[model samples]
Target: MKYSRLSIWNIVVKCCMSWVILLQACNNSNEAIEFVSESYGEAEIISIDPKKDIDEEYSMKASLIVSSIDYFPLTLPGDMVIGEVAKMIHHNGYVYIFDRHTESIFIFTGKGEFINAIQRKGGGPEEYRDIKDFEVDRSSGNVLIYSPRSQKILHFAITGEFLGAINNKVQHTSFFPISDYKIAIYNSRLSNGHVFERTFPIQPRFIIANEAEEIEKQDLETAYREQLLMYPNSSFGFYQVGDSLRLMESINSVVYGVDLEEGRVYQRFAFDFTSANPPRLYDMEADELSTFVEDYKNKKVGGWASLHRVNETADLLHATYFYDKQVCRIFYSKNNKSQVNIGASWMNDMDNIPMPLVETTTNEGELLGYYGSDMLSMIVKHGKSKPSQRILDLEKSQRDAESIILVKFRLKDF
Candidate 1:
């Protein structure tokens, strides 16, 4: 006895539906993100421009307000004179300063009230010499102070207690703590013209893997092959999280993020460095390159290159490029992490700011020892020009007098 045609058709449909379910399971398995040992291409600045609607007026307005605030004059406790301020860090509701001349660390309230000195020049614990930079551990309340001359990043308690030190032979240009156990270190040198990174084992000893060395370790051939794997034509920056590195870049001036684990670069950002114009290139002689690099590494020339984390998702990112005499630009991320814009500070009033560049070996004719901001600020030595004139006679040639200008900026939606 055979079944009706309609019944046979219904059975066939049920079998087809069962097969579809099995196929869906297989597709999901294949779609899982696979691990690969992909390399990345050499990064270069593609394009950048000042953000629209920003101008000298806005930056001036902001500076005038911040300057007038009733902040205390930073003072050096004890025998220290609090010489020149190398950097001023705002953390834990306080402002920390590093004085180069006195070789001491000064602490102040957020509003600029002089609190106390953290360390002094000595060859023992609780002492420091040639302190280059310092970073605060927001979570553990520990502080990491780097003395480039000493080539060490010393850990200390926020209250001036000494902790262990990490001897990462690599000269740390900068660093950001991702947690109590891990940190991302940015390294660069005048001898080498590239910026690279390394992650340390979060322990106080901070043992670094040899493979996490400089970018030179990566050959050109590897870069070409992995170039496609990189977020299509984007500017990238790195952040640390435990043993992982967060890759950030801009598309059309918009910032994007990627999470990296075990050498894999995760693409998390959506924006790209946006510039319709091609990049501007300049080639200098070997001697000139050496001089420029040395000045930058030794902190002789006044300029700053730093990274900032924008939002909680830790998705947004920005880079601050500070030029001497107060003119600088902020590269900000756009929506969808696809584009970034180079925006100027309209509030700091940096128009007509003087940018002074000098060679240290030939310093007899110059008065300004260095140029930069008050915090992480460079030294301005006595000059040949009279104090009344406020002139910087860089050379006997009698260059015209110009005033130094500084600007401040914050993020805003257009």
Candidate 2:
């Protein structure tokens, strides 16, 4: 693939990209590969930095991106109480929400009909003691949950029947099924990682493993932190962006594209936060790793940024990040090279009223957000700017209901 390339940069990008590493298998392989990270830094890829823009007010408005809004009021029965929405996934005409507190997955139809809940939280052979993370297998319609406590991946039917479990030797807090053979995992060993985090000084942050649980390959190390706390992030995980599976680091805005076929990982996008990243944890010396955690706890900064979600519509790329101590959402226009920034309440010009946060996104390329009952009531009753009759009718129909209303919207092409 490199030979047919025109420029040297293209050749470098094709075979062993700058940050794209080809690591040897962890246990039984000693085939060394050059870990080159400098040759192709952020200069080659597109940088979506909001600091470059002069406008303090967000350029992106609800009207510019939102073509239409949908309200799916979920009907909850007496047995079901969604304690917390830890993770949500929409697939095959159904919506699955994992409640971490309850250790259960609640299923619902696309149109807001209550279905079933997968509540198998036991120490049996089929049940998982705890769920680290879960992904709905697209090809087979099976629910794959990784339980680090049990060191296994349990498979369950979409309708909540236990199929079986796969023995996993690899240490991962969360995993994304690349194919039947390939799986991309977020390494469990971080500075403040959860239960299964090892005390070893060095640990891989990401790994590619097989169904048998043996490591095929791994990349990036977690040697900077003083692994003492318990903070496991299943957010900013292996999410579908377009046709590719993207992995975004929690501390910074560097996103990687995972190749399912070659078991390769490469940098695809980065947000320029020069003031936030330089001279920090990654650059600390071996001796500094000892006291760095305590120092990091006390040290505060104004320029720090961490990406929360990166999703897109056909024409606009949406990204939400914590920048300079404020939560920001920016929509970058693909056609005009413009950016719209909104801090809260997307300017729902269609309704001539404010809408709640449009944060979560579905795999079908639609934005999924929500509004609690109290807030929605305030918007309808208190806002001086009245909503359009269509939006008013939608809210009025569910006015009496006391539940969180899910807002599913598609961005306009313009």
Candidate 3:
């Protein structure tokens, strides 16, 4: 069932932002993709009125979705350290973390053991001066690090051995390897002078291009751009469920499923959050932008604009988003067609303990969340419910470490 990396997606300016996605495939694409109507299409919209959903107080138990959990104490030896985790992906029994502070990718085992790192921070022809992001070659298990500093995607073995590099025209950052030949770029707006003047034609948010920098596939439909002179660290991300590669847009409510081997986008989702006072700042003036920012900061607008990360089971679609200028998780039942608000983190009622961390989702049926040892110490000291014996022992072992504790749990088909 090996498929060629036939398409690229979500390529553009990758600067001062963050994105972590582990793309997987099942059998096919399409998650609630239906053409209701052109101009009037609220029929298929999965309306999530946060105020109503949050009040219902739906809770999901840790034991319900997960049969087990593993806490990985991510670490490095001596002066080496995993700085800030810009993006984390758990795939194939390995956890790959892109460290933003050090601009390196650190690899670890599934059970909290250090393996190796994929970093060559230097100014050589085979070296990358800077790494904007990294991705794992699903078909080959190779580590591909995208370096804007040297304009190449350096390939390396899982053992940190340099294999080679691919030349890319993606200048602003945020590009990923779709295959050995194609790359995905997310060029939302003109972020820099080079892209504005020389690189690409005016295109949509997602574009697939070959090494020659020729556009291969792009959606004809477009979105209005915000003129903030800055882009969200993750403009858009691609996630995989079963055999489907799904997309969760960073700025809007629509989600898509893509068949990369065929180079077509399956419009998988469209959510109507009008009940949540979503922002409307398209073509807004500077003064208008300032007003919107201040109002949002003062809690005047609903916090349902950006769709960050999403994971899905057969019964539920889970995601995280910018909620009132903070991160919060939202669960939508496919059958119910409405949002199910499960506290800041999973309520963990089944475990009868509070997980004091915000988590992200993956279509791979995994929940990824992280907390430093300091917070773990606090949770053990003054938490309401009793944590599992495993957590308490972890807190004892990592009492004075400079690394993060990654919470990895498998999800069930709710």
Candidate 4:
């Protein structure tokens, strides 16, 4: 029997609707699978710069020590190696030097006289296994110490009394405190079923890591895993600038902004370093290989930036995507304006540059300075040069030179 045209049309429409539903379900399932795979396996690094050599000249200049005109010779525990200063936090006229190797915290008066050591190795309320970083709450006159390995944040009175610990849950492997109540945390994940986690929270925040999916190219996966192990969660880093909190995410080495206030995120920067000269990977699946080819076509291999808070502002520093160059472009936001500038030779080519050494106009276009770096590297790579591991000396010399600068200006009439 022949059906009515209307009836036939209705049947056709129902079939089409069913197909649409099936397609949508499949798409969602694939997404879920991909996400689960992302957690189970790992991605590969098609290319990288194997140059691990620390430039000696750069290290020397970066670690240069000078006589303190005021207080001098901050005393550290004899057991702790007074490695080159990794970071200098000046508050209440005292300089706190965090030594990486010695895992010690040394305090000195602004006049350069040694004060008392802040902490020793203990799990009690007053002690720390390792102090990853420290910052002064200028407004509160409180010292905040972040111990990533211990997963704790300790608040200390200016006189070295432990006031209390910041109570919150976090999963960052590394962290930097931005203020008395704020800190940035870094979390990373690798495929060997090993997770590197550290927590720095005065707020309700969580760091989640998922194992990556297994790719056909083991070498690429190895490289990606290795880099991730060295510094993972580049995209998911959290930074606190004053009262504003910033979360940065990375997708394929491109940087994205996390709208914590809005609970939304989007890509803002891309690093395509590996696009031109793709790295070698053997026997990648067609779909997997296509990603690299597309990256090469887009010239987006090495483009990436990480977030760090400098003097109460979030600075996004990035390297040329996919390129092995030792350069970082910094993006700073201030006075409701954003400025971008290049911090050259921060580690290697830091000499001859005076105070306010590096400056730039950011995406929103503003200028400000307070010299910042992976000072931890200075301690981690100490003794490569012949300079005495005097953190106070290094800090004194740098405080006078190379610190962020401010240039005076006025709007001119055309």
Best candidate (score: lDDT): 2
RMSD to truth, every model: 24.3, 13.0, 10.0, 21.5
TM-score of 1: 0.44
- Candidate 3 lDDT score relative to the true structure: 0.58
Clashes of each: 46, 5, 17, 43
The top-ranked prediction according to TM-score is: 2
Tens-digit per-residue lDDT, 1-414, candidate 2: 011111222212211111122121112111221111233353223344535553333232466567778778788764455555567777767777776667778778877788887888899998888887888887776788888788788888888888777777665556887666667887534432332256446667777777666667767665635433422121366776556677766544566778766765677666554433322344456565445444434342123445666665445567766544344566666677666666523456666655544445676678776654444555677667886786677677766554456778887654
Off by over 4 Å in 3: 1-44, 53-68, 75-79, 171-173, 191-201, 220-235, 277-305, 313-315, 333-339, 350-353, 356-364, 412-414
The candidate, 1 or 4, that scores higher on lDDT is 4
Error of 1 at 292 (Å): 13
Residue 265 lDDT (model 3): 60
Order of models, best TM-score first: 2, 3, 1, 4
Q: Report, for every candidate in turn, its global Cα lDDT versus the true structure.
A: 0.34, 0.59, 0.58, 0.36
Query: Residue 7 in model 1: shift from native, Å?
Result: 95
**After superposition, candidate 2 runs with Cα above 4 Å error:** 1-60, 169-173, 179-182, 188-200, 221-224, 227-234, 274-280, 289-292, 300-302, 313-316, 334-337, 359-364, 381-384, 388-400
TM-score, every prediction: 0.44, 0.76, 0.75, 0.42
Q: For candidate 4, write residues 1-414 as lDDT tens digits.
A: 121111222222221111111110111011111111111122212122222233334333432321111112233333433433345555545556665545556666544456765655678767777766666665665667777556567888767788877642344434444444444444333332222122111112223221121111111122222222322222234433434443443334423344433433344443332222222222234465566445433444433222222222233332321113223233323232333333323332123222221222222212222222223123324424333344335554544221111121111111
Q: Candidates 3 and 4: which is better by TM-score?
A: 3
Output the lDDT of residue 304, model 3.
44
